[model samples]
Target chain A: MILGRVGRALVVSELVERLRDRWVLIITALFVLLASGISLYGRSAADAQSTVTAPSIVTLSTFLVPLVALVLGHDAIVGERERNTLGLLLSLPVRRGEVLLAKYIGRALALCLAVGVGLGVAAMVLEPGHRAALLALIPPTLLLGAAFLSIGTAISALTRHRATAASLVVVLWFLLVFFYDLGILAALVATDGALSQDTVAWLVTLNPAGLYRTGMLVSLVGTEALSQMGLAVALPSTALKAALWAAWIIGPLLVGAAALHRRQAVTG
Target chain B: MKVQLCDIQVRFGHLLALGGVSLDLRAGAVTVLVGPNGAGKSTLMGVLLGLVRPDSGHVMVDGRPHQGLPRMEREKLGYLPEAVAFADNLSGRQVMRFFTRARGLSRSRADAVLSRVGLAQAAGRAVRGYSRGMRQRLGLGVAILSEPALLVLDEPTGGLDQQGLTLLWEILSEWREAGRTVLLSTHDLALIERRADHICVLHDGLVQAQGSPDQLRRDVGLPVQISVTIDDDAAVGALVAQLQRGGLADVQIATDIDGRHRHLVMETAPDDLLQVLRIVDGAPSSVRDLRVAEPGLDDVYERLLEVTR
Candidate 1:
């Protein structure tokens, strides 16, 4: 049979393996619970107030998305290679690129399920009346999750040791999710609240997750409130803005697939 | 032909892992690649399985080239690496499922393969708890799951104990009886001596010798050792000297046992036994036990190595 037909089976097997693993399952559940708790607390705090300036859904998603991405992706390829299963995968007629793509899709799907569970619970508890509003965020959140995993897959493929890959991913996550904001804050401080619009536009574009978070916030708050918070910095006309974000998401995936395609199963 | 490698050369940095290695495997036969460490056994297996690309030459499956063939081609090839690491987080069933999917087999079929590998009881147990031999057997089970046209294994008996080895040999023998090609690389001389049909001796990144076991023994020109018991060791040295001097034999003293009953064992060509007996007539009561040492693949391999060196 053609491998493409078997692709879903391979992916499902990976999903099952991930689900069966005690550490991964426990950690994933804990992460879901943490996201659920944060979502509930943030929504309650926002709703208890008489005003609805900023949605706590955006706050919770932006934090939880990267956390989930980092956790799910950091070990996918390197860990498999380290465990020596990568050679077994390569020995099969499956292309290296296909394995990478299948794994990324499989883990992203599992993470999406977790995100659904977490958000579903949070919505049931805090935003039962805003089900439609909460449901609107799922697609973009899934895209964000996929994008981060693609980057993580590429990083893992390039490193031989899992610990090194995890350490590097940790540093990368800190920079992209946390340190990049600090750098922007430093730049903002240096400019003495006189930051040029173009500089700020480029800064946000440099971090794909930041761009995704910004887009999610804009979608939730509407143009007027987003403009009030200066969060809608240079989001182009809607069509162009969507294309830019799409590029930000798929660019890493394309690069990752290319890298995976050229890699040989040489590690023993 | 089940698998064919033609003039393949795989180089790793400055090291040439396989230099112009070529061989063919036939169905229902055990083809053993025997060599010392770093003799390109693993590299050759990797090339055949399409896991490693050679710097030169091509691998053909059945009659067609293997490269660029879709994954379906690989589904017909089963491989067991020398050192196998399974998915630790997965249960044995889950791990088998991965290989089943890779081979495009049913999940139910996977359970059957796991059972065949003696992993039925541990099917639902995590692979992290499996012993090394269990993991190796699991790997073998995965390799043979599809009943592929060809099976490529690297040191399949590396970590197996006597019982595990015996069980694996039985499985391999059954596979052989079913008209499947089994191309295995091993340093276990005993296994090769007992099991291999077509033997290839690889030395220093080259094919040093290739033939069937009997044919290889002849080609290697190994000595025939004879253990003959004699009554006295006093005349053994002179007997050896007289045999050498009279152009009677190339006899070498292998052992000299001294006790209330003394015996001496001499190794020589099986054809020269009559001449040796004539030379030992000086000690008429010397003869007791006599047996001809059967030539083995190890002797063949050693002679081949000596000639190449």
Candidate 2:
């Protein structure tokens, strides 16, 4: 459905507020500097006769983009509620669903812009030959950012305190980004590496960050490397991976919106 | 438009925020809700705004039930919360623009409201630097931006000084003149007493009494107190004896601490006011000063609370 005038205005208002926040600016700058540093390192590796491609960008973003997205979105709802502005906003004609959707779209726009600028400039400066692979990496990286943003937005809606929401988002980030792969590895080792290839592929696809990483790697480095590393046995097609990423972005957002709708507006 | 609350009941956890309260807020009039702290005024406002759902009962605005009202219909209502908080980073003008835009209005409208609230000079300043009263003015500006048919204000006079209070009354009067409905919750009895067309006294989550100020006084049966001061002690004693002998059983007399002035506090019905004045004129003592005090909203409020307790 088309967002009405109120929804569009909410998005614009949220964008303006986010752009003015000092923390958002700092995090955007950090994304640019870090992406540039990674691109420069890849260039040095290329100078040493090693090939650098989209997998290099994916590895950096597997850690950096999710953090930036989380920081940008973790307080989207709870912060407004805690600060007493949500009451004023909800008192208007806008529905709770519109507010939540507008916030997600607004933050998503900022995340995409930051990631595009950071990676776009870096690709131009360091690896002009591999610019196409870098460009291919941007969409999956953005999907990854959107996925984490959805999770953070959900957590924000479930809590009333900003500190509590921030803490929960950090825990979620660690579990999905850092611990998921380690848990998979420990499971493989405990099974004496005898787990079926299909099982391993399904497990890898379950984590959004892992799905993003593998999707980027297969796109840029071909399926041959993934097969050799035993990470691509039953790997689905590119369309399937994109669909999964979309699910990750849209699913939690709907759940969060429902939760927000069920509750009363914050008041003093 | 008129707003009607029908047997509205709300409970938060174990605390009852509102009992089965019914009220009719008429159009083209200002309804002042007076109550003690924690008397469910805020919760009632929330119910009216559709922010807090009632456990039982519903509200009807202008003829349609609140839930049945379309988004455009709901947009015709405006609300000013007890504490006005905005994005501190945004300038006052930007805050207004944000709200105006959210309601599908233009920046020119925002500018108009800023000027209307007398905040045009400080429009460029960040809200973080605004005083409490200035923030309230900004809140007022936002509430009136759409020229809503129904305006709900919660303690709109909380941080206002005398001038701000006067300005607020002027705005309310203008809105009433425009044939819009204004529902406000306030504890400033002296300020709202003369201005409210209807007064609803709420206590302990119940509508203890609701009427026009005079109607409430009549319902409560509170008397008009007439205090007469006499400079001479002998005249004070003689007037007290004469009032007693005149068989004015409802009149109670007491001397001031100086024992020079006699206070004849009488519970006279409205019809007897003239007779009471004549009696005082015919008394044996020369009345140095006479003060007639009618039971106002404050007195009605206190009496209701005391009777209910």
Best by lDDT: 2
| Candidate with best DockQ | 1
Query: What are the per-model DockQ values?
Result: 0.57, 0.54
Q: Candidate 1 on A1-268: residue-level lDDT in tens?
A: 3237446666887688667667656756775576566555556555442123125556656666776676677777777777766767777776677777777777877778777776666556555554566666677777777777777777777777788877877887778887897898898998897887656766775576777767766676566775675656676666776776677556766776676566656522
lDDT (Cα, tens digit) per residue for candidate 1, span B183-250? 88888776668788899999878999898998887766555666656656666666667877877556
Candidate lDDT (C-alpha), each = 0.73, 0.81
At residue B307, candidate 1 shows an lDDT of 83
Question: iRMS values in order, in angstroms?
Answer: 2.3, 1.8
lDDT of 2 at A203: 90
Docking class of 2: medium
lDDT of 2 by residue, A156-260 (tens): 888889999889888888998899989988999999988888888889888998888887777777889899978778887778877888788889888889988
